[model samples]
Target chain A: MTTPPLAETILSFLKKINPHQPLPTAEQNLFELALLSSSDFITLIQLLEEESGILLDFTQIDPAALASMQGLLAAFSAAETGSKL
Target chain B: MDHYPWLSPPDHTAQALRMDHHLWHYGQLMTHAELLSRAIDWSIAGPLRLLAILGNQDPWVYPAMLAAHRLGGGFLPLHPAFPSERLQHMLHQCQTRLLLVTSDGLATLDQLLPNLSDSMLCIITEDTKGNRPLLFPQHRFLDSTDLQQLPARPAHPAPNTQAAYVMFTSGSTGRAKGVAVSFANLHAYVRYWQTHHPIGPGDRVAQPADITFDLSIHPIFVSWASGALLCPIPPATRFAPARFILEQQLTVWVSVPSVAMMMERLNILRPALFPTIRLSLFCGEPLPTRTAEAWRQSTPQGRLLNLYGPTEATVAISAFEWQAESAQQEPPGNVPIGWTFPEQQAALLQEDGSLLLSAGTGDLCLAGSQVTGGYLADPDKSAAHYFYHPDSGATLWYRTGDWVQRREDGCLLFLNRVDQQIKRHGYRIELHEIEHVLRARVGHDWVAVIPWPGGTQPVRALVACVAAEENSPTADWLQHCRQHLPSYMVPSRIMVVPQLPLNHNGKINRAALQQLVQATLFPTEAT
Candidate 1:
């Protein structure tokens, strides 16, 4: 259930948008839980790009996995590593 | 059932719907509607009873709508994601007789059950997942199995003048009001799309909008009227819909322009990526030139259209096609709303409270069959917006608040709003409505809601400014807003200021306040 810090950044950013929401579990699928919508997922990607200083390739990401915080965090770490390599 | 192709499908074998791995033909869809309609007719005795479909976006939605009309009742779509309080007001406002639930809507129905009035909430669903008993002597569940056992009963087609559906839009009075669109009104609008456009049996249309949104009306009617396939894209796939669109080989695409903005953000809008798309219909918000151009490239064989209208006018009344380029006449950047449909009449309401028939810029007004009869049961609101124009020989005209400019060539350009109403993320919102709810909670009149980076551009946030308040009740205000207003209407930020900017006439200076809010959002750009 544990994800990288980038997931923490997304959770914090989501909190800013919907202030009333409680933090979701690391294994929880934000989309199914209705905590975050698909539109919000795209917005989170833009915010993550701004914070990470990398242009992530969304074509390489698995949409189903990206629905969870841990999966999103893992994708971010992979994108960061890919950019450096 | 007369003009609708779904009644007796054009080709019973032709595919009519694609949802959740099931591809149902026109006959199959009609059977579902027939069976469901008989079940409804048996349980609820009476014609013209309103049926409210409460659920997430799903395939069963269209069938439920058909079932309602099949029994001569009206269909009302309610998004379960909205706060329970707002949904209660809508249900009570229309005196909903039956509640139709989809598989995805179970949790939402559970939350809404306790708060409902003492009267029975007649529910129709497929899967109950039963464990706890429902309220006795009041509530009842009618599942698919029950519907299958019911004997066949003929559907009573309502009169054309009767309402086909009633759509609820944001109300500045703090509760939403319903715009009752009759069968005649719906047919008048849908007939235009069917006759004028080339869409036919082979086309597969992607309805990317939620049922609650009026934009979704286009695909459901336009496709079914011509025997085309209707694909109600799931909510999870909407923002990132490239794969689904490509996989379905969708031929027609309909959605808000902001969705393309989302696709643009995700870098999914590449040229020629959606070659199968033959028609691109954009409405519910202004279409940016950049988004339109990218979409035009994506659909190499398609036509890109920009349309404009309020929910009161039955979807859209005007459209501009991208391929018909008179480069000299078109304005820069923002796409024009083009011309009103030939079947309707358009006039301008000038600044001095007079009608302008031919030229000049002013608030837009529409008249004809497409104009709604009136808001449900509220003659006062009906009087405020809908009226007969004395100069036009008593023709009923619906006042559209959009500021528009018309040229000698009959092309229309969207200027701006004539009021504080704004479109945030393709959702029509009245800023005054947000302020109205907050004023009651905060117990003050100083709070003003402003769309950040304002003036027709995409709104990033709704910022509330309170004068002379030392502490910002940001968290509490958000909690209160979540319970009262829809998410899009909720203010993302609350700023405590010394005093709100004011004009010399003692009015809140909106332009000055917009500058202040924008400055706060982007501090480095502030002077």
Candidate 2:
């Protein structure tokens, strides 16, 4: 999946499970805080893999990889190419 | 004298709740005090035997507790998931004169009333819709109004040292022991925990485990002591509990590692769910390293603490916070229990009785006010477990049969239990505990119990019984067990064997039986 698509998928999965949170966006801001949480990030990754067929290893994804929507997109690209984007 | 209600006076009401619409507003919970006061009034005159049907994550537990106190009657909280027989055994064992069932929970008692009618009094907590209350012809149903009309005249306090609650602990002897934790021990425990950990008004706590499991004390007493809102969560949703945590904004989270693993599987770690989870406490079993790592990774800002203790030690003896940096420094799966709680005094004692305070692994010895006086109605077992220290004549310590090693950092890491006790999926299981219940119900002389957890998440039991019995063990055992043990402790499969394998010493070799289970070749292998 493309970077924007991966971010959108994760954002949507988080939205589905916990509707209490204001809707997350593909843009980088407070949405980055969701990736910092292990439970939310794992949920995002699992949904991303199931929906978009992109494999994200929790250990491999660094802070910068989840810093912004563009950065998350790039990380997906790196994961697709089997290297750090 | 210390107050009978040992809780510190409540202050900072804003700290009373974190998440909104979770259970009740502070004002609503206060209204329960009057309701609870009325319920307590009814119980003061006679022995009120109450069986608390605990499963629904209702915040109404506090009021039920207040009512239980007012009646001068002790509570027998049973897991709703417990099979009919186990529930019956609990009701009979407690000599439960009164039962408190929720309106939605009336159907569970239908099958086991015959066995329970002698001592059981069925009391419904809420009203059912269309179903008229059927009289078992012998059982009495107490309604919500009956709860409200509880007499106001006060009675003497129930014996604090007597068995207030008796839940089964798993053992190797194939029988579950009813670990009777007294009100004094529970009271002392919460008091000690409060002095050290200190909870207050605004703290919202989650009751995640089934109440039958002793670990549920975290939500129960912690909330009561601090006047914090106690939000009970269903056991089914324990795995994906982050949803509730997020929805409710709970500040305190209590659960077992297996439940934590389930949470990881369900993916509830988004920031929205865990923003307020400051105190993430794990007990009932060791926090698996992978699970701990997941928690550390997920809630980087949250404080992860691990508590270790048996029901015999009240609720917990020692605790350690999972320092993210420290855990990251160590290899995977090497998480250590960090330290003892401030109020608790613990020491590792060798089999020879010499204190292993400096180094080495031994049975964890617990000493403090929180140590229960003794087991109920089982003096022999209690004498064998509670020992007086030789050096100090007055200092008594309870031998916690659990094996653990003291780390260089002063934290203790739990090894295997010395006896045949196993902590499966956060339940302290004694194989013999199940066997005892089985024998009591089935009248069987020869029975060998072993856990078979090769595939299923819950550690199901494989029972080997005398093959010559006219009635072979089957699903009926499940019904029989439901009367005595909690639902999780029941054996899933029973295999009747002509004879059990005995070693050269002529004792039943559990390892051999476990091997048979592991190979999936007990009486027969699956297709």
Q: What TM-score fits each model? A: 0.90, 0.71
Clashes of 2: 42
Best model per lDDT: 1
lDDT of 2 by residue, B353-448 (tens): 787766679988888766776654456777878888876567778888878888776778877678766667677777677777777766765776
Model 2 chain B: lowest-lDDT 10 consecutive positions? B39-48
CAPRI docking class of candidate 1: acceptable
Off by over 4 Å in 1: A1-25, A28-43, A50-65, A77-85, B1-10, B41-48, B127-136, B324-329, B468-471, B524-527
- Weakest ten-residue segment in model 1 chain B by summed lDDT: B1-10
Judged by DockQ cut-offs, the docking class of candidate 2 is incorrect
Every model: iRMSD:
3.6, 14.8
Candidate 1: interface RMSD equals 3.6
